[model samples]
Target: MRVADVGEFGLIERVTSRLTYGPATLLGPGDDAAVIAAPDARVAASTDVLVEGRHFRRDWGSARDIGHRAAAANLADIAAMGGTPTALLVALCMPPELEQSWAEELADGLAAEAATVGASVVGGDMSSSPTLTIAVTALGDLGGRPPVTRSGARPGDVLALAGRTGYAAAGLTVLSRGFRTPRLLVEAYRRPEVPYAAGPQAAGLGATSMIDVSDGLVADLGHVARASGVAIDVRRDAFEVPPQMRDAAQALGADPYAWMLGGGEDHALAATFPPGVDLPPPWRPIGLVAAGSGVTVDGKPYTGSAGWDHFR
Candidate 1:
């Protein structure tokens, strides 16, 4: 049945009923507002919005995938700040004609992804709209550690990354070109795997600066560079592009390096560490921080476009 058939409160009941939460959630659904425990007495909060045809396409992913992506996008931001996600607030706005089942599936996806990080959806709101939109706000615990912000990189710091890059952008190309590629690549575009632990791990290791690679690696690193007032020189040979990304790029007669440098939504962590600091297992050195400005590839300026922008 359509969402209009059940009304907002009834739909909320159906969606919240299927979720499983933890002790962090003092008061969950069916409350005026969710009360979640902030163990460190400090919470790191971030929000993300996904709009139909802009952030995603219904034809490209199921409601579940859309929800998962929404959760990942917001949670990764928390992780980027060296925090562990504790709870989430999701708001859904959709056309009245949208199916109730779709909303439930979206809720299920949100719950499952949040559970991966031991977080729960504490509260949210629903509204009728002309289109589908998902807005997720994530709250995290820093565990008494200082947040790893983009402004901390030093001139002699080493740049590193945790998790894959360019896979999602390549996946988008594959689908657009109608090329038959590995399911993993396509799924990468639909459901990104964020490195949830690396952010905190980096903080524990004295990372000078950090950010989730939501935008392209170079683009996101540029944020760190500009904020820290340093130059980031990425070593191209350091990147180990998976064969799937290469194959997908070849199919479209496009450069895989472009995707690696420009693709966003990978949810990987890019961090800057002291020159001699030992990086944890998940972190791999991909570049170096120097006294300058902007991001460069192998000591040269990157000429390609700098990742996704909400507006031109």
Candidate 2:
């Protein structure tokens, strides 16, 4: 049935009824506002919006895929701050002609992704719009640890990364060209595998600065550089190009490094730690923070687009 058939209240009930709440959620959906626990007395909150056509295409992904992507975008931000996600507030605006089942699937996707990090969909709002939009606000707990920021990196810090990069961008390229043979790349674009645990782990290991790699690595690192008043030099050789990426690159005759360096939406975590600290599995040293400003690759300026920009 079409969303209009159920109307607004019905749609809300259908979506909220299927959600499962956790201990952190004191008051869930059907309430005016959600009351989430903040044992640390501090909340790390982040919000992100996904718009149809611009952020996603219905033909390219299922409602669930978009739902997962929407949740990850915000959850990763909380993780980047070295906090554990507690709850999410999702606001969905869709055309009335959209299928009701699609919206249900979207809720399922949001709940499933939140469950990965032990979070829950506490509340949200629904509205009718000419276009489909998913806006999510995620709250997290610091657990008494100081929240990591982008301005803490020092000249002697070790630059590190947690999770894959460029896979989503590569997948975008493949899908844009009308071929999905490289299922790995396509799936990466569909649902990013965010290293949620790595954020708190890095914080526990004394991460000086951290960020979610929603923008391209260089672009996001540029934010860290400017904020910390330091320069970041990434080793091109440090990135390991997977065979799938290489095959896709060869097929399209595109530079995988461009995607790796400048692609966004993978939601990986980039952090800087004190020198001599040992990085655990999945967190590898990618470069170093130095005494200058701006981000560079192999000691030279990056000529390609650093990352995604909403407006040119």
TM-scores of the candidates in the order shown: 0.98, 0.99
Pairs with backbone N, CA or C atoms under 3 Å apart (clashes), candidate 1: none
Leading candidate by lDDT: 2
Clash totals for all candidate models: 0, 0
The local distance difference test score of each candidate is 0.90, 0.94
Model 1 scores worst on lDDT over the 10 consecutive residues at 173-182
Clashes of 1: 0
Question: Model 1 over residues 6-107: C-alpha lDDT tens digits?
Answer: 999999999999999977898998888999889988999998999888898887888898888999999999999999999999999989999999999999
lDDT, candidate 2, 97-182, per-residue tens: 99999999999999999999999999999999999999999999998999999999999899999998899999999988998769
| Residue 117 lDDT (model 1) | 91
Give me the overall lDDT of model 1: 0.90
Point out where model 2 deviates above 4 Å: none
Alpha carbon deviation, residue 65, candidate 2 (Å) = 1.0
RMSD of 1: 1.0
Error of 2 at 71 (Å): 0.7
Scored by TM-score, the top model is 2
